[model samples]
Target: MTKNHNSQHKDLMLQNSQKLDRLLTRLCKRSGCDEEEEHEGGNESVLFIAAKNGVLEILEKILKDKPGAIHETNSLDQNVLHVTVENRQPRVFEHLEKYLKEKELWESHVARADKDDNTILHLAAKLSRYKPRHIAGSALQMQWEVKWFLFMKKKMPHMQFLQNKSRKTPQDIFVRDHEDLLEQGIGWLKSTSESCSVVAALIAGVAFATATTFPGGTQEETGKPYLERHPAFNLFAFTPLWALFCSITSLITFLSILTSRQQPQDFRKDLPSKLLVGLSYLFMSIASVLASFSSAFFFLLRDHLQQVVFSLYAVAILPIAYFGVAQSPLYMDLMRATFRNIPQSSNRESEKLIL
Candidate 1:
């Protein structure tokens, strides 16, 4: 039933896409102008709308039908690249970039400035009006913004230092525009660090106590643990020390985050990397501490109450499972945002647009 429903949905979308294609073709023919040509008044064209909304299929179709439309600019002198970057449409931008580079028009198109003398780099530096649905937190969002600016900077090296009409360079615009976001990111990082650091500290303290006091009392003569010969002894022996080390490492990492200068550049990699490391160590510590407790419980109850040992193991797993499920999304997001590669235009020829 689920597969059938999904199939039906996909078919519907395909049908809708076909109808849209036909409508666009007819409109282009009737108007006797390309997709980017203005409508009756000064309203934006269909091509501009598609680029802004990241409707890659529509944009691709239009570009294929009328290649010259790629050069047309709106009243504000903003081209397809400007629209895509301002609206945070990475896919569309990538497609257009590849198309332009293939045509050997990359330098000319990328160097175009709008009415305000704001280059594509300047537009990239400005924050988009829409919030990114994929990135969760404000801090991660800031990280993406910085990453995008840097990506555009690399694409147009000469334009990076060029000032706009307001006499502000792209970097200057970025700093001025993202000041509030930077502050919010700092606050978010500090709060997250503070909360996680407390947990790490508590785990460290517990692990230290457990490591000092072995599961079984020591023999008076040899001063060796009575349970040293037992099978679970190795687990009980190793896990607490591992837990202590991991928790201490987690604590230090979080402390670094809390104490970070948190410049805008830090959001690009440094801060997120630290947060990822801290969270990773914290998770390892939790698992290790739970394993130590479970092993100790299993050893104590193995001979007397074997059934209780299984129950103890199950009980020990519950918290770790809960923690994993609860924090998995955040951890995954951080990992992706911290280490994700910037989208690059591919060398392959652009995919043919099906009309």
Candidate 2:
């Protein structure tokens, strides 16, 4: 037997299952060759190897051949599910776990411990010990950790309180391992909240000034604004007042975020909740500020309506439309994602986020 065959077959499974099938056909015809046969030093059976590498099809096929192979262990005595999580193969774990349940071995397979008495839940939380390259941002990294923790809590409620040989529960391990990630998450959340607050403050200042300054100047004796008799001037007065209100609300909302306690748990609902409401108020302020500008400008140029006023209004409303058009999709996504009630049992991937 060429030593290259097992290594070659493993590589084949990773790249193309079709090519692996062709290679398996030839390998199976030869004498004394088998997928389940272990290599030297009790290295790894094909089943454990596939799970570690996330070759789901090969893992499934090997299990089909020997139903009891679900209980097979590696040199470290870690079963396939443990190996899958240890190697950071979450997708593999999902598929493999479901398969074990289908085969009526969920209890036996998931409960098995490794040499150190660390079960699959331990391996899942163990992921926080190292930062993976694919999870790019700190906030998202914290979210991923929460997602894993929740999944494990739902799957094995007893596992939360179960301590390993190191005497650390899974939650304890997460808190210990993800200290840096948690700090970064706080920094990112505050930075985002403060930036939005600045925009809200500027809007508040401008709208307040616009509300106090009458467009056509005040009447000489009564001290009431000129053009107050015109119906459009009421709109001119009210829109800026409306804008000022929304801007103040937005400013207050974002300021509260800066003062909030920056906990990892806050990111799940509290932070996103504030962000959604703040953005909504800011968007309202921006639209109303533009409306106020349009109405006031219209009052000044009302005499020129036939010639230049229509063109001027269209030119002025561009910024409001631009702000609306640009931010609507993001606004909609935040509203939907932050408020939706996802079940605890389901493993949900985070949505594509924009900041």
Find the candidate with the highest TM-score and give its number: 1
Q: For every model shown, what is its TM-score relative to the native structure?
A: 0.85, 0.68
Which sections of candidate 1 miss by over 4 Å?
Answer: 1-18, 21-41, 343-355
Global Cα lDDT for candidate 2: 0.71
Tell me the tens digit of each residue's lDDT in model 1 across 219-265: 99999999899888899899999999999999999999988788999
TM-score of 1: 0.85
Q: Looking at model 2, report the run of 10 residues with the lowest lDDT sum.
A: 346-355
Off by over 4 Å in 2: 1-69, 72-77, 83-98, 128-136, 218-234, 305-337, 340-355
Score candidate 2 by TM-score against the native. 0.68
Which residue pairs in candidate 1 collide?
Answer: none
lDDT of each: 0.83, 0.71
